[model samples]
Target: MTMEQICIRLVKVDMLSPVRALNRFPSVIRCCASARTDLMRTNSSSSLKSRGSVTAAASSLCLRSRSGLNTCITAFRPPAERVPLIIQPTREFHTSGRLRALPAPLIWMVLKPLQKLIAIILGRSIRKWWLALPPNKKQLFREWTWRRRWHFVGAGAGLLFFVSLFLLTHLDESPVTGRTRLLVFSRENFMELAQVTAEAYMEEFKDSLIAPSDPRHQVVEQAVRILAERNQDIAEISSVPWTVHVVDGPTINAFVLPNGNVFIFTGMLEAVADIHQLVFILGHEMAHALIGHAAEQASLSHVVELLSLILLTAIWAICPRDSLAVLGQWIQGKLVQFLFDRPFSRKLEAEADQVGLQLAAKACADVRAGPVFWQQMEIYDQLRGEPTIPEWLSTHPSHQNRVRQLDRLVPEALELRASCDCPALPKADPRVIFHQAVKLLLDNAKKQENIAQEKKNEKERAGVILPFPQSPPVLTQGSQPQRGGVLATSALPQTLLSK
Candidate 1:
């Protein structure tokens, strides 16, 4: 066709949008062209205007150069060089120019199916996937959808019920701090577990026990008695029977079980340069029991166990992939334990340190010695040259972290000690304490994030704690058509959710 006839034909094509037509037709569009083609194709109104003042004229089409595969399109030129069309050709370096048009009927057929496909898959591609599934699978998908839509409501109600049950049934107050605590197990239960662990330890080390006549054994026993007697006055502390033993081991360690069984390694005794350090260490171990650390740990573990069972029930009902569901169950359980349980464990340890200081200061033991004792432990850990575990991995805070924490509570401890008519102890160097404080602040900002903050993060990450503590995840294709939308959180551990 002649060029004017071709332009009129293009303008008459109403099925394609301007933009779509421009994109679809890559060559041979009529009425306008690159600079060289402009002289022949452009209207006469443009002939008077200089190139710098080129203007929009009514003649129109955009053509991509077939020879170079270069795209050229029209733009308004001030509408000001106001009467001539300007075509800017964005080109490649091929030294050629040519054009041709594909047959419109052929183009229409080729594009129609593609356009329909695009429309079908726009943001709902998974619907097509669902339709492609087996009849059994489609039923499963619908069931999952129904559960997701409805289970969230049920889970919310369940969580509120369980939380209320916990608060009402397990209300126990902590001594010294006077804060109410939720303790699912009784002190008697803790005593039983403690006795079992203690008996096992005694059997393992019976031959290596330090003789009661030994001066070291005598000193440890006396210190334990003093600290225990002071802490026993607290209402939270059960008057659990106390038994202190010194093991003749090189490992510098001491610990107390939930029941009042205390074990001190000879290495720890030998490591201490002074009696006060030993006294503070004793207080720390005792405080773990006094604060009901074991009970709190048991409570969390029990909740996770219960939640995991509920999760598995939901998984069995929702998941079509049998093999993958088992793997997912294991992963989610670990994640719940790691993300939700471990941080609380660390918090318990930190809480013990605080209460230990109060207990030691009240017992007439100089609580200022706690930092010095922890510093010694840090030095010992250094000599072993074991790789330092990162805060996220370790159950205990680094010794430096302990010392920094202790430094903050020193003034209060000292004041408590004075109130209890305990002997005055000299404070440590201000410069050293100041440096420790600064380091801890930096470490906290950089690494030791508050656990609450950690849990608050990554709600979208897999293994994220579902708002429902024991509620099975919603498995609806409507909410999570992809394999991992909700159940993935339950299967992955804290590590997956961490980043």
Candidate 2:
């Protein structure tokens, strides 16, 4: 046969799809009569023995060639079964070299088109499902069927509502800073809450409460009276009936109600450097009431909850009311607590710091004591080796953060103090002050016991006949004094602990 005719019978296998390989291979060469004759005549026994060696060399050349092909000569096989690929040149041609694999780029080229095709099919399916919606729901899609367009519309509407609500409120002025704020609750509501809450606290701590006679009580009373009397701009200070209650406890905390009711724990007094630091702290607690932070925080908390609910509702609208909604709710809960509630709490704390600094400065208390008071607190926390919570997760700022803020506020407070007549008071060690406070209490108790003993001696000297030989001890008014220098009070119910 001629070379063109011989080439016509050769088949090239395409690895991509072997069944489709032979169509491209047939009839691919021009005639070469002499070359075909030489290729056809390898019948001698010697020539047959050398055929294998010659074939191996030819196959090596094919693989090493810069040009690639799926072509080779081999033993013949029937068309029904998979042909065994052989690499040799002889009179007969067999299956092409075991089909050449496609290049990486070519495989990617095929997949790219397939991916686009699948995406188009998916989009069409989503369109069909969308059209099956009730006619009323489809009204928006009548003119604009694009999925992204609807997303933008929903976002824009929500943003507009939020901006309008935020901008359209009446602005109320903060007491110390005079910064205007959007207050949701009335001034009257604060006093009402304060009155109820303060009375409940009073009833609970009535037993173990200290009187004016207690040195800690005397100091705190003196400070609150001076600060509240001077800073009458806060409605709570001016309108509410002011009362101070000192409870002997180890809990280091102080709080003031809008009704001008103050609760100071003995532990707080023990932590103070002097009456000035106590006064400075008292001013801070008072600021929380003065600035209406309680009411403002309550309002903001509700607003956050409402916004979260709205966002969840929007998610349910877009997503299937199934596992996706559950996931969204979990995410929303975390964001509301950590992002909205905690940060909002920190902001209110910072605001109270500024207001308290101003209040303390005006009251003639050493504003520098603010940093000192917090320094003591920081030390106490360190001694306990308490883990510091991250600012994002904690409701209160870290001690270092508070100390830095207090330090910054000091210069301004000092500038205000410079103009006042109260000369800077001498500073005392907090540890020394705490020791003295304890010693004073011991002295007072000893004096009271001595007075009781003298009174009993007088009775015996007067020859008074006792109705009962052993008299039951008469306890002091309201509260019972406990041993170990500790005091106990009848506390409110468990429900009030949450408050």
Candidate 3:
């Protein structure tokens, strides 16, 4: 067979699959060699004709698999006469003729280990340059860097100025409180993000969610409605849509989405002492939504991440050893969390408390319930025997601190309530009532324990066991009781028997 015939068979084999083609490759090469040997022997007298046929056959196989096949085929031909394939798969990954080539700028990044290569090359070059420098020269270089240190400081200061300007430009006042906060994400964007989180929660608690017809759902809806309808001062109460979902679990928690979706757990219902406390809880969550705390926190987190990333890069670039770089990063992360993240979170929580109190007051839902709710929470925490995390380490203010802050804001909240035409609050403070109720329950429990203990002590002192009482004899309905209190069914009066 001619080389053309062999090449055609090879194409057919390759068409089967790349792996099959590779597996059959050696067989094909052996066949080709055998065919070449046989042809050479048979056509030894016709050298010119054989060479012409071989050249034509090689040309036919060009561009079979683009560059790879072309190069393989060209090995059989003289280098001077070899023709380069126009379409090279090695140069561009895409095989389709219709699709445009990938962008030139990205080709180096996509097709090569450019970053690794650059890092390796730069590291070795720096090492070599540093080693070549004499001790005196190195000392002089250090002194020079020290002398020019102010330039580096100025550069850092300039960067800080720009960052500060950026932050100032993005600062926005929170609703109701008018406290300025970093808010890079707009309302629409944050709501979109919040929608994802809401969906995730819905999916997670799909089986546990309370139906709208459920009383739990109704209670949450009623509370939310009261707050939204009566408290118009909260700008977001009217602007954003509100939704209520109750999860049937004992989480003792309620949270609000940025899009004004409120989730209250049944456990939270059981935790609150009354509707007034529930109202305060709902107001607190709603305040989180109204102030756009989610978006503000997200913006702060993004800024923190950016700053951390820059610090990490500087650490990695400047540190002499990888271990030192890792250590620096660890310390940097903890510092950022303590100094910026947690404190910011606590501040937001405190602000939510203050604003939530105001919202509850405007709704005429017992403003004192604010501090009372926190006080009850503190008591519950204490009763549960759960270890409390320190305030600085926690993302929320301690319950004690929250109670104090709410107490301070109560007078102002009461004034606001009065201006809103709300009815006068009852002379009875819910805090005192809650404390009294808890104390009464505890006292009753203690008295029950004391009574049980006294009975046990009296039994022990008597030192005599009581015999078991015998059961009364079973009797028919017609049986009459005799003087001895024993039933006498068979001995009836003779006159009654005759009748």
Question: In model 2, what is the error at residue 293, expressed in angstroms?
Answer: 1.0
lDDT by residue (tens digit), candidate 3, 268-331? 8777766667778888898888888877887787777766665665666566766776687688
Which residues of candidate 1, in runs, are more than 4 Å off?
Answer: 1-163, 235-238, 313-323, 426-499
Model 2, 84-152: lDDT tens per residue? 334432233357768645433334335654643454345445545765799877877765757577788
lDDT of 1: 0.62
Q: Local error of candidate 1 at 44, Å?
A: 99
Selected candidate, larger lDDT, 1 vs 2: 1
Give the Cα lDDT of each candidate: 0.62, 0.61, 0.68
Q: Assess the local accuracy of residue 317 in candidate 1 as a C-alpha lDDT between 0 and 100.
A: 42
lDDT of 1 by residue, 1-499 (tens): 6665554445345223434555555353423233324433443433222233233343333343335442334434343353333445444674566753443333433665564344334323444455468999888878888879768888889997987887688878765666676676666666666676788999999999989987777777777777766666675454677788989887768899877788999877777756666777788788888777777676656555555555555554455554665676677767876787777778877888898888778777657667877775665555455577887776778888988999899998889888876554555653366358547755654443444345556663655665622211222112311111111122222211121
Scored by TM-score, the top model is 3
TM-score, each model? 0.54, 0.53, 0.62
State the lDDT at 169 in candidate 2: 74
